[model samples]
Target: MEELVLYGTLAAAGASGPRNPQKMKSGQQNHNNSSIVVCDLHSGTPYQTFKNVSLPRGSTLQAVHATSDRVFSVQHNSSVLLVYHWGRDSAVQTIVLPEKLAVVKVSPSGNWLIGGAQTGRIYIWEVMSGNLVAVREKHYQEVTVIEFGRDDDSFVFTGSKDSTVLGWRLYDLVNSGECQPVYSWNKVHSLEITGVRLGYGLRNVYTSSLDNTLRCWDLERNELVSTYILPEKIKAIAMDPSERAVYAGLINGDIIIVNRYKLNPTTGMVEGPKGNNEKVTLTYQDNSDILLTRPDSDTKASVTCLDISFDGTVLAAGYSDGQAYTWDITTKQVLRKLAPQKEAVSSIQIVSRSRKVIPGGIKLTGNNSNMLAKKKNDTSAEIFKLPIFKRILDEKEIENHNVWVKLADAPKQEVDDLAQVKVKMAKFLHEPRFIASAKVSKSNVAALTGRVKELEAQLQRAKDLKQAKEMM
Candidate 1:
């Protein structure tokens, strides 16, 4: 069981803001220490680094995502999306977008890629076909967050600075000529939305806003489920795998953990906390919520990003101070402290490693010639390449897109092949053994027909003799 953590920085300390277009354009020429680092979780040593001439000196906040085989990141203040493979040092493909994207997310199945642009427009693309499926402007301001439902990949949830969250079905966006959201919730928060998370079955959606509130909505009912008010602005949010607890990162460098269920003494069963418009307000003095702080109290760097491990036992957090920390959930202790970047940590991801297993363990003998020969002789290894995305969608390409359908089970039938049957018969006649067997069968059938005819004649004569005896 091995895991790797990938993280990138915003910009070097004392550098200009990432939104400066002039600075971003000159990033490639300048000698900036900008790279995506992949390191081991247990040990803080970086094992792989993705650096190339095409990557920007600064990356936008939460603009990075990793799939099983590729890594995706957006360039700050630019319309470029850098894609890198696992073992490649440079970007394999640089996707040119119509506008600069604030955030991007790859679908769980790795078939679709969706991004929210600075102009509040959403762009969706087919990963394999390189087709721009949809480009729509729905938000009034810059799009901040984009997420796909874990249980249902076709369901997408997006939030923006307009203080709205919209739910969409992927199929509708791709197939329909004019697409609309399945559900839209507007004016839920007074300020811009910062983070969004979907609960089990995609029925419950949790969102955090700068208005110092964490609101949960019931997608099925299209209503607000619960709201947790915090003292300070919420910068980032994450949930455990079980959805039993929610974690909110504050601007004051405090991580608050809230439990969704409470124990009922009378019933002796756990029940969800009742929702009210003005009931729940979490404060620093409240003992109901747990607070996690950095070791150094003087450092008040806000948490920029947060991600929980697959097992829900560890929490990875990145901060404005360019540090990433892994915390043990149960013990509430820091497992590792990694601060390799000089700028703010914008993204963090924890992914399991993929390994290839051999049928039997290789022997470690002194003779290494066999291993070298096997490696030289192996030609089945394939180099994984990222598909080059088309900037503009072509009508012809869309019309030619292949549609997939699942065929139902039916009775199987052999194909009729008259020519093949004739060829087989000709071969059978040409064979000496088959010809002898055929002759024997033909002679046996003729003899049996003659014998039957003789038996019929004998029966007729016996009947005549019986009739003569009767007359006498």
Candidate 2:
């Protein structure tokens, strides 16, 4: 099996003081721990860390996303975005935003970056051009989660504290300048949504809320498919790649695995879980079928984030206590426990190792010596660097922008002039004038054939006459 890595972010120590009084006193200055831990998922040992020295002293909630070559993170309670290269320990670039973002997500193609702000406004930026394409506000409360569809970057789903989930088409935002959402579901959850995940082909969506319920929505029909009511408030949720199971992280340090399909006893066919309201209550007793408790059960730490591997065999869970755990999906047991951070673990992601490679098949060795030397030697190359993001969309710049497309030469093919003529003739056959002309040509051909036959007969008679004259 290929080794998987986990990227985790820790919240500021005093950021959650108002929410949890036991952690810290209210009105305390939030301490910044602007670092991301990259660890081996199987062994739970960290090998690399990325830090930003210039970020303000604050927290980072679930605002971390990584691409093939870079990691994007936002400074919670501040209007700062940090972009880091995999090989660099420090951030490569720091972007200052106009407003504080609650969550940020990168599109699957890495061509677009979007952030949901505390004011319920969503901003999108084109990665290569660094142009702000769209900035729209539709939610009434703070945006909590932003998720692009699985393997599909054209569609985005956003959940807010107003208990509404809206889906937007990326093309409309970028090209048409229409910031309206394609679909909006407002009455599904009564409380604020915490997590949002899309199913395969973007057909279904799964969301968890603080209302103690996990709801599934069918995007094709725009209707609610199923709702599972849990005992505790659901804080985080992750779905497997195959969509066979859903893992919900609760506030009480418990993880609930709800199987979407179960075998029927009579027909042996896979069917959904059957019950009125789908009420699933967690207990400490012998019902180990769906519950996975934290190792330190005595301590009540909320599960802040959850992510599953691409293969769906491993699950990574992050807690408010700054601890991270890896679990085996088949056995429902803890595979490894990572070292705790100084504060709460705000976000966790399970990604493959291949994503760490740079564009030129060069794996990042975490050595900045070569980069420093290259930068010092080549000042002209800096001119081609990506432009800084603009705060507002520039209509004049867009009108003057030019797009260049490199088209490959098509393969050479031999052309038949007679075939071309025949095709042209075939196309005109349906015309009235052509039809009449075709009939005239056919009659003329028949008359010419008859004339040729008559001439041949006359020629034979002449030969016979010449033979007779010669005999006489």
Candidate 3:
């Protein structure tokens, strides 16, 4: 062993030392431990329970909505749009949809909102005005779905189980009467118009049906572009932004992605084996073909409503049960499962634009900061909901803090660094004394900032997961 090590080390270590240690940047040091951040936006697991119904008992809870700040559970009733908050363990703003509120959408510009409900009704409301500007009840069977066009708000499309697809001019809405039918096909589905979507860049509308066929519609010429049949009835349809492929989530526990890829010169039809098995293919793009199936379980289901982000990075599926799953399209990995809905998601939309603020500016720490103010609210009235355990928590938390400080005291670099930060941070906690002293100082600021960020991220992730479970 020594001879072998000597030979290899001499041959490889030529100039530098034998140990290939990683260098620590001045302010970029980090812990060796790995951590995960589960977002309600993607594939985090949720905890759920239900009263038995029938064979598909646990799966009926599926309402999903995606907006700029939140991914949510949709409302079937005229009640209110649910904005699920991963941090609050509850929902915010149960938005009342205009009219009877069948379908709702925040425009691509994030300025206007449109709500379409039963009996061919539509309402356009400006969020800033918090008031409805116009109402058009033009449909025949309750607006079933709504899709906002990209790049411009010039036009939007709607599909109804009434077996019709309509494209309305956003600019000429007032003068536009008897809304023009971009495309209409009653033969697309016999049961109910399940889903309709415009293909990316194709100017053609795609429609899916309870009858199990996905048909493309050319609104301008009023024609059916093409039709592809699935193994079973259809539940959801999503077209990737590239327009080369489309995914039809089925009632057969299968996600069938069809590529507009033609196998032969004259044949435009593309086909693959159908089953509850897992499959992935590379055709339309990197994440072209994918098949989703429930694992070995007592429950089986068909996805009710599903959506994929524009870039095809995030894919979400809402089940008949009040549940939603977000998937990493390329890796075929589940990222975070939004909490399950109490009922099946009538629809689901994803907000594609998300960003991290570019370190806005210099952060000024001082005594008057919010960190100091939160320390003052240490009352049973403020801390507890029920009267029984309020005092007990205050006393226990106080003791716990002292115990933690003592336990963390040590001579090791990490331990010492942590202990010092702990004491300072304790002074800035929910209840503390001399909160001003806890303000961050520039000295060793990077280390402290990284540590604080790490802790906050970990805590936020845990909080998001817990909320997701309760929401389910």
Candidate 4:
């Protein structure tokens, strides 16, 4: 099992104070030599760092995705996908993939796990059984990113470095092992695809590529609705909670925010011309841009990944130089900037959903219990008991005995009445044993009084006899 890594805890954010390069070396454990730091976004500071996690000796950490209960991480050049409880060093499970994975994602429901491999074969595993349910070989190059539809886990989206984006129906993959995508667009980007996102109700899927294009697709109609070609290569993207807008992080360390399509209230579809609208011209917007470099600084760090809070109030962007910034999405102002580390921040995840915190500070949510229950039921041990032996009897005796036993086995009410009677009778018989300890009776008093009277009469007679002897 790989050593477990946790990024955040419920502790005070300033427990470790600001990030220190000297303390960074001490923050890691001796056995595992790296740390996964947890930060409290509410306090905007570092909370805790876990270092005891075991990883493949020479492999580097890849992407990290977490639900309310568990944190899932993958490693480069390693086939094992390590799972850890939120804010703990103990690994709950390790899933072995068919091939080394470059990217991994868990459904919002946490019932599914998908690992994208370098060979373009995507492995899908059912979280309940931890079994590989399907292996999809749709992309020709490395699968760069994969995401589940926000509405549910039934739909999955994948983008490959081969410059294509495909939408897969999970039901078909699990039921029939179908590798062909239900919705697909080939060579949508001129360069490698970097990020893929399922916008809002999953009706719109977004893709960002190195060719400097952000394409939006209408998955329901399988048509490209809009495309925003940028000035620089885009590395990462995140959608707001309301699905009103999307933020794109570019290689130039600039964060670009773009508005998404509006939905029709009655039809619950994109509020545009319906059906075969592929001939419709695409709309491109380019006014939103926020630069990361300070006024006094000349160096610019490339934005590597982006994540928005559950409420869409804050936006977190990770840069190529390991620096990270959190901005208030409404005001478009920087909230906090974390110190730089040695490696680039490949992914950013904001802990959002509220969870029931159990004693000892562990989360006792439904997902954690389900994971434990699955592990217990998947074991193959069978229980066995020795059979009892009985002696054979003659038919006549057996008949007589069986008849008596059946007759004695009366109704439950009658059995209960008989038990009460037996208890009363036992109490009545035992009353005699306690007779000596009972209170004194009238007969015992009368017997003592008679004995006293007899002694007094004897004393009077002796007195009379002594007087007669004196007179003689």
Candidate 5:
């Protein structure tokens, strides 16, 4: 397998990608190798093929910091995703996952995408193509959540409503034409999974279940390492850039911040020997600390979607009431907001990609409308001086910022409740049977301990109002 490794990395990555379409034409190339599709959001909406694709091209996002009268943020730009336009007011892809999209992760380099479908299938898509690159159906009840291991191996791991979290090598799933579970939990959770996220570098897997708690697993050892009990059912989970503690959003509109008390991210290890596999240590305790938060400070709005930029400059939360707000992570204050949709946001991502808009550059000529002409008439009428024509053009331009997405109405899970669900899964991890299964390496365990301290410092800065910035 390693023999062809050089070929996969160096040769086809660029330069010869399209011309040597020989591999794709042969139909034998694994979907894992490539998936490429592009769309024009405006003119080709109805005729587009892929249903799950959408792009934010040519559209302007409502600037959250702007006034209501401003038109730039009202409409969006054209995107390559599947766009079904019933009219001017309609153009968003809708997909109903078999269960709920437990976890939707776009690859770091943007080559591939992965998400767990409610049908207990691990859905893999090619990024630009919006194609179902591959599908791994291995779960029984439903695939509640999934994460791609952040290691060089690039494996896929999933947590299920059946109370199980299983790991699999990606290439194995691609070549074997079937999903073979590496680890299975007869009872991973008492309820459904609502929140889940893989650790930054794949040292751990964290999940929140309907059972009202969060669970952290040691993937290498296949054991439950620690658990966190939140104030309410966990709804969303986002790790700090440092991977210290995670900010979990709950159904009750509260976010619980779980601290490692002692763990490390850099080395992927726990400091103390806090385990049950013939191991004993001082901090046998689980969950160093849990802090409650409200991703959305508004009293009435429930968070529908949440995302943090890679640099942690913006923390955006989409509401069930059809509003999206950006907050200052450091100061914890709302910087800008938009009420764009009437429906809850199925997903929210602080993507760096943006649509480009070019104006028509048309000029208007009128008898009674021009302010420049009024001065020439010697009547100097200030009543007709409002630059009405220019305003009309401005509004026309504002409402026309046609934003398009690349995904279509293809089915997937509704991960809207993920953060809260992982919290419940935490309890199951705390269970003795599960604890006995974890592989806590001395270095792995020690690494986790150190990362905890590093993350604590970051979270403290985020909580202390020393952080939070406006996003572009």
Candidate 6:
């Protein structure tokens, strides 16, 4: 059993999803540890959990949003936004805003991040630098939802509790640093807007509101395309890839499927089959044409959030009672169910890519500055100790002495005794090599005199020998 426990710990540490452009397959922020849990969709297993992530004081983890390789979470009633990357135990970046945030979203290209505050302000940031690109006070109440343009990252749509939805060009927001909304629709809903989604071609923006209506607006013309009135309050909405269906999660714990191409109320159903067409109008507590009914665990719990998988084949729904269900979109069968927390599940996201494990942990640690400081400290103790002014004086004096020595052999002009004394004094400052060379020359002269005396003595000895030979 001890060995098994160790094995499980190791598996949890290394078992990650994929490292592609899509950062996560599915993720949620649960009550346990107030952490973000990433799960593998194929295996329906928990891949990794980010723990002890930093949030604002007195705040809980309210939402989890992801970019290509980073996961961001916003805190409830707090201005702090926690950023999580692979292999990090704590938030790598904590972006603090002026006010507390209620919702957050990352762009499809992973270049921008946006957070909506309860103060009716939306803050936009460039992801790479964490620079605040723009802040707009476009809503009168709390901002509820922020969504990127599905076709491209050029535009972003936001819905607010003020019952308005505004669209803005991302380029203008970052470049001009202005909070202007390019397109504005006032009082689109009679109540607070809960969720917003942009179509694949960006031709329509779908929004659900507390007023119990799913409204679609055309982007190019900035006009209403259609409205599907539901019986119960719509809490969240998600669209499939084909743009053929829009799924609405209701407050009564029911999921409703609305055909995207069909069911225009003003005009009769025209494009789709007659049998497929259902009544576009809904009454209170109606589940007659619901797509997915409530599970036994979440019988009357409000569906708080909903997400569609990348392939549009799976639907993941989170409930206020903390039940999370994954369903096959085609068969409307529950594939898996989980309850990670006893509290409400604030958000749910379904992505396509696997997990990314960032090697060597965090990339920012003041390492360069630390190395520079160490190098400075090591060299500060060993100074050159150079003689400053005194050394320059010594060099100048030596140069003068050298000039005196070089002029020693020149013809001496007639001068006074005092001048001659000054000349000798100047010569005294010359290098010692002059005195050394003079002593060496005198020693050679004495050696030559001794050799001559020895030669004379030898010549006298030879003469004395010659006289003795003559006497014989």
Least accurate stretch of 10 residues (summed lDDT) in model 5? 1-10
Where does model 5 exceed 4 Å of error? 1-105, 113-116, 123-134, 149-153, 262-301, 354-472
Candidate achieving the largest lDDT: 1
lDDT of 1 by residue, 1-472 (tens): 5677888777454433244333332113223555678877767676677773222232234588887677888765467777766666665455667777888899988888898888889888887677787887788888888888876687998889889988888898777378889889787798888888987688788889999999888787887878899889998899988889899989898899977887899999999967554347888885633888888758989988888888888888888887888888998888888755766778888877674322122111222211211123343332333344656767787778743322333656665798779879899889999877667576888999999999999999999999999999
Candidate 6: tens digits of C-alpha lDDT, residues 1-472: 0000000001121223122312211122212234455666545666666664323221111256765456676654345555666445555544444556777787887666777777777776655443454677778887778888765788888888788888888887656434678788775689888888887878778888988998777778777777788878998888987778889998888888886665668787557423221335755455455568865834688887788876788888877665777888888888877535545666777655434344433234332211111123243221111011110113333234321111123555799999989999889757597767556577888999999999999999999999999999
- The predictions' CA RMSDs to the true structure, in order, are 11.0, 13.5, 27.1, 21.5, 30.4, 27.3
Candidate 4: minimum summed lDDT over ten consecutive residues — where? 382-391
Please, what is the whole-model Cα lDDT of each candidate in the order they appear?
0.74, 0.72, 0.49, 0.61, 0.44, 0.62
- Comparing 4 with 6 on lDDT, the higher-scoring candidate is 6
lDDT tens digits, residue span 1-472, model 2: 3354545555554443123322321112234564578887888777567764222222223578876556777764456676666555565555666676778888988778898888889888877666787788899988888999878787999889999999998888777445678989898689998889998798888988999988887787787777888888998999989999899999898998877887889998998755333555545466578888877889889888899988899999988887888999888889988877766777788766553332222222222212221233443222122345667778776666532222334656776999889888888988888887666577888999999999999999999999999999
| TM-score for each of the candidates | 0.75, 0.73, 0.53, 0.63, 0.47, 0.64
- Model 2 misplaced stretches (Cα beyond 4 Å): 1-4, 10-31, 53-61, 176-178, 273-286, 355-385, 402-472
Residue-pair clashes per prediction, in order, are 0, 0, 25, 5, 97, 4
Candidate 1 clashing pairs?
none
Cα error, residue 117 of model 3, in Å, equals 1.3
TM-score (C-alpha, index-matched) for candidate 2: 0.73
**How far out, in Å, is residue 56 in model 5?**
19
| Top-scoring candidate (TM-score) | 1
lDDT of 1: 0.74
Model 3 lDDT tens row, 303-421 = 77777776676776766554566766676656665654444444455544434211211122232211111113332111111001011113333234221111222445555787889
- Which has the better TM-score: candidate 2, or candidate 3? 2
Candidate 4, lDDT over the whole model: 0.61
**Stretches of candidate 3 exceeding 4 Å from the true structure:** 1-64, 70-99, 174-189, 265-290, 326-347, 353-472
